[model samples]
Target chain A: MNYEAIVIGSSAGGLSALKSIIYNLPGNFSTPIIITQHVSSLSESYMAVFLNQLSQLVIKEADAGEKIKPGHVYIAPPNFHLLIEEDFTLNLTVDEKVNYSRPSIDILFETAALAFKRKLIGIILTGANNDGSNGIKQIKHFGGHTIAQLPASAEVPIMPQSAIDTGCVDKILSLEEITGYIISICH
Target chain B: MHLPDQLNNIQNIELTHFFELIFNVYGYDFRNYNKAHVKRRILNRINNLGLKSISELQHKVLHEEGFFDLILRDLSINVTEMYREPGFYKSLRNEIIPILRTYPYIKVWHAGCATGEEVYSFAILLQEEGLYDRSQIYATDFNPIVLETAKKAIYPVSKIKEYTLNYQKSGGKNSFSDYYVARYESVIFNQSLKKNIVFAEHNLVTDGVFAEVNLIICRNVLIYFNKELQNKVTGLFTESLIKGGYLGLGSKENLMFTDVFDQYQVVDAKEKIYKKTIFSSK
Candidate 1:
């Protein structure tokens, strides 16, 4: 099968960036997308509501043990780490933060790597920290396609730079191009 | 100590052995857990301890004093908060509360209670609903360290804001601040909330039925286990509950694939609350 899932991670300055890509996706873009964006725990479930208003696809905060479905976006809520279980269901953990970030992009990407294996696309976007670098590496190790946002195009370059440094990034593209590229590869 | 930049397939063997070591030594059976989660947690411990490989970490785990606790904590994965998934709590207050009121005395078992945030949150809800006097809540976790913290019921004042929002969303009728007293950097919840609570050690994996509770709340805990363990824990939950008693799982958890799938009737499917039927479907 082709790519079954796409996992994206962002940190500081992630909200607007995520909106730009998610809102721009074509109506038929149905591959399941999972996102982990660093935010204060105080944000609660507001991020899901905010993103749902922008994207045409069904968007909601991921809950533990929810079955993963195509044509929807699952956002990791603050103060929790999201993982993909063996059964392709979403799992949430209140486990200690990774890279000082709960809902760490790395955790979601790594688990999705195992769950989706070769049929996965891992994207690391703008974030001030190196949270998602190792995750994308894991994705690449599992033979999944890995993409990193071009550092110059990011609000914060450190995160993408770290992923690029791993030498595992298969492509580096602008958010606009990334959106178009995602639509291009699947169907 | 020669660590590669990337994990090779051969590393899977070492990791598997590490799980075996943990089970043999500590009796925490994580052999069949989701591999990605297991690997990540193992990698975390390896990095944290400045160890180079899983074998070395396993050696340390077997030989060192108190080293296993760190691994146990990592394995426990206790990231939880008050009034998580506000909708579920909302359903409990609006719908389950009335059913619970039918019982002269209520017993609730918060299996894998973590830091007792939910238990405390439920206590606050019970107090507000005037049901605290008639309730006995057993908050248990295999990780006694967290259980001790749960017993303390003190939380960083920083988290209270989000929790306050959750409380309001879950249909709190009173001021959220009334439940907690800000003291120093932490907030101390009212002692009365613990009046009906029993905090203790209970491992769902290895332990048996503890009580015939009216409700068993085991949210976000089952997802860590593999299918076999998940079913096993569900069986424990099924047996521990009285007939027609309730079982409230985490929002994403469902009875769809479990052995007890047909044994309970859905009370609120969205909220993952189920009531036991008279006959156990075996």
Candidate 2:
């Protein structure tokens, strides 16, 4: 699959899960990875900083109007919903929170689906809320690939379980398997 | 994942036509707005109203008397709060306020000041710094309904606690509770705070320069515009600001890639504050 972009959603026990996945990816990875990990609206991008130190991929908090590029991991900034424009530039909004979460996983996945369509891959990771459930459905509806972390293997299985329950997910893999699969399919 | 690419392209064409119809009939120019944002809002409206497509919505917009007004509200993303990004306000106090004090009379244009929370926040900051009497704030938004709410200056009482916390974080001098009168379910800002503010309906996309002010605080508004519109609006800001005036953008927004990059020097990088340099290029 010639994927152009990958949209990820995580919450609850997401930091370690993200660290495991992002650290294994090589510096030359071509797919631009965009992630939304649920955090407090008042929090900073310390998570990005911490993950960047452990990852080969260039990782940073996404800035509005920044262009999507290969080998860069963009984490959605705290307190703002991150969106991908059709031109591949990022946009941030302070619109009313959906499912009580700003930087809502669904918002990112749905927008990316519209932008990249069949060339996109949507992944749902560890989370307690059902924020990414509808997003996975939207991605499937838009003809984008969908993957959910294996609920049993997740730190907090509720999020991935909800996403799987949507009946739209294509694959459910453990953290290690998921990382290997992404590297395999992306190349 | 086998859907044809034409699905999105068809929706895109319909959306462009819908925006053109809106501009030609109502004069609210959203043609330059970010496509994803506009589409999401329009799609949400469609889902709620049980409409099929943008074409169906367009037909109702043309014939229905009050339908367009609802669409206008749907298009306007009015998510705002007092002291949004408290660090920006803190920077305003430590970095920008001292410079503002150098001037005898300060003029501030709060462009895209939706609901005027930040405008009042600025007014409060000026008051604390003893510059309120010498300041004039022009608070402008394209939406008249929001402008009306700005004039009323009332917000839900539930939000006061959050505002108070932001005030403290922003280095507020006095008790935040002192600034407002709490009614049953709402808090009305003190009448005195609004004395220096002039709320008006001025569209940034269509409106011309109304004043050459010392400061312009337009936060979180430019993210809705595409790159071309963003550059054009930043140019408008550059032209409206006096030499050496300050322009505070949303924390994520910057002028580094814009055409006006060379015209301003960085004041505070973390807060996205920039000061216009003398000797304009354009």
Candidate 3:
């Protein structure tokens, strides 16, 4: 399938895992990748900039009303839920936190699943919580592809293990295998 | 089209019909709001009501007494906190207040002021700067329920700790504790802070221009709107502000692609502060 977008969720021990996958993507990587990494409500994160330096994708914080584009990475801004509109643009909300997370992975994944349907790819990486388990199910329900970082390879295995428990993820791969699979599937 | 694609088209038509039913019957224009946000909210209501689709919900809305009110409450974004973005408030104090000091009397409008926490936060900032007496704050929201809460100026005591931290980070002049009286489980703000403030009902989507003002703070509200609604409300703001006035938006929102972008100059890009130009090409 020709995927249009990829949504990623990560939390504890996510920074290094993200670096590993993002740093390996080619300069010509064309699929748009949107991510939500659990950060403190007050943190002014530089994760996007930090990742951009070592990666080929043009990485930046996702702003409200932004149009999704190829060859770019959009990180959810702190203390806001990142939603995808039907037109493939971005919408941010200060709506009540889900699973005690403002930039909750479930919100992003569920909205993106509705927006992109079968043309979407969802990944759940290392984290301490089960925030993205329901979201991964939504993606699978919509016939989208789903992947979870192998729990044994993750720094905090609970997150990936939780997603695995949902029986929705299509692949369970290590960091290196995940990066390779993304490049092989995405055009 | 494939089966899923065909289903999506049908769903879109149903949603559009639902929005029209709401607008015509209730006179609230959520027609041009963001689709994802609206859909999420409506789905939540559907699940709660044990209804299957927007069609079913619409039927209940038309037949059941007071069901629309529940939907209205669900649609209205009432989530807010004092000093939500400390950097924006800090910039307001250091950059915008200095300019407002030049005017003899100042008028500020908090458009879409949900539940009024930020409204009181602004009032406290003005008081600390010794500009409270000269300033008039008109805080408004379309939801009367939230407006009533705003008038009371009381909030859960559980939120006080976070608000206090936010206040200090926003360069508050006095102890954050000094601003409120904690009574049991709620904290009521000082009456002095509400003296120069007026709370009212104003709908950004349907209401006309509110008032001529020197500053307008409509933060985090426009993200709920679609492009057309955003531009329309922004035009209203442009018509309401005096030349050289200020406009503070949510950190992510901007006039960059809007119809009024050229009329305002960015004062603090990071904080999303814009100053209306003295000479507009329009």
Q: Which candidate would rank higher by lDDT, 1 or 2? A: 2
Predicted candidate 1 versus true structure: per-residue lDDT over B1-282, tens digit per residue:
322324545467788888887888788878867666777788877888798778888888889999899888888857788998888888989888998999999999999998889999899999999999999999999898999899998999999988998999999989999988998999999999999899999888888987899988889887777778889999999888888888998866778789988899998987899989978653
Cα shift from native, residue B190, model 2 (Å): 0.7
* Standalone chain B TM-score for every prediction: 0.95, 0.97, 0.96
- Per-residue lDDT of candidate 2, residues B107-186 (tens digit): 99999988888899999999999999999999999999889999999999999989999999999999999999999999
Deviation in angstroms for A144 in model 2?
2.0
The better candidate by DockQ, 1 or 3, is: 3
**Angstrom error at residue B190, model 1:** 2.8
Interface RMSD (Cα, Å) for model 2: 1.5
Error of 1 at A25 (Å): 6.2
Candidate 1, residue B24: the lDDT equals: 83
Q: What is candidate 1's CA lDDT for residue B187?
A: 96
Error of 1 at A173 (Å): 2.2
